[model samples]
Target: MFTPVHADFFNAPTLELSRNLLGQILVHELPEGVVAGRIVETEAYMGAEDRAAHSFGNRRTKRTEIMFGKPGLVYTYQMHTHTLVNVVAGPEETPRAILIRAVEPVEGIELMRERRGKHMPMKQWTSGPGKLTKAMAINMDYYGHYFTEKPLYIAQGNPVESVSVGPRIGIGNSLDAVHYPYRFWESENPFVSKFR
Candidate 1:
């Protein structure tokens, strides 16, 4: 049986967690079925100094409050009609997180297809933040939920031998941080998002 990653895995710097998250498996045991994917891309965001971060300058709000909580929890947010998921990082009181940018479908393709409706190329299955959330059935209800428990969790996966690093995608307001190399992805992975 595959074991879920320990909370300690997330109890580190957001950047470290972001890079290491590549190749990990995100498993969601939904009421309908189980869906799993291999993380192929991630972007790190830090508090205050990192202008791209929602908690920048310690600006905490109801929506961003969970970002300041202990590591190993989910920090889900909605962008338009889609919900994106982030892994809360850093020690308590420190607002930081690693966004799961992309993943390669690993299991439950039928369920993912059912959830996503009709059909799409395998490359488009979970190759973006919004796409993966919909494929895995992740939503705002997961906000602030601990990843160590059921319905959803990250499991140990193959170690990445090499990775690519680049600037994060979107967020045009943070001029200086836009050039920061906060994004990490598995090298040569076609499912690592179109931004790569």
Candidate 2:
């Protein structure tokens, strides 16, 4: 049985949580049942220095408020009608996060298939951020919610040792940031984002 870590675990510095979360499991409990998956892909976004980050240049707003909250919380937001999930990182007031881009489904296959609206092969089920959220039943309503407890949480799992680093995906505004290797993933993981 897997259990979630305390919120303080995720409150570490941005770079630390960003790297340590590589192999953790993100569990989503739906009314149908529990669906769990191992996180394989992530991108670190530091507060002021990262141009592609929502908190870039210290631009605070109602939407970015949760980024400043205690870490280990889900900072879900809408992007072109799709809900993208990110884990809040860094100490209080420093607004940093790790975008959960992909995951490999580890439990509740039947529930995931139903939510995806098709019987996708394992690799296709949660290969993208939006797709993973869809499979896990996560949405904007889950924004600002704590991940250590509640409908969504992260659990300790087998750590991924062989990981590859690369640039972030789909950010046209960030000219130089597009080249920064902030994204991390387990090499040979079938569920990694195809965009990279």
Clashing pairs in 2: none
Looking at model 1, report the run of 10 residues with the lowest lDDT sum.
113-122
As for candidate 1, its clashing pairs are 48-57
In model 1, the runs with Cα more than 4 Å from the true position are: none
For 1-196, candidate 2 gives per-residue lDDT tens digits of 6699776678677766777787899998877888999999999998878899999998799989999877887899888878999998887788888999999999988889988877568788899999999888888998888888867899988778898888889987887988888889889998998974
lDDT leader? 1
The CA lDDT at 24 in model 2 is 91
| Regions more than 4 Å wrong, model 2 | none
- Give one digit per residue, the lDDT tens place, for model 1 in 8-56: 8887777888888888899999777789999999999988789999999
CA lDDT, every model vs. true structure: 0.90, 0.87
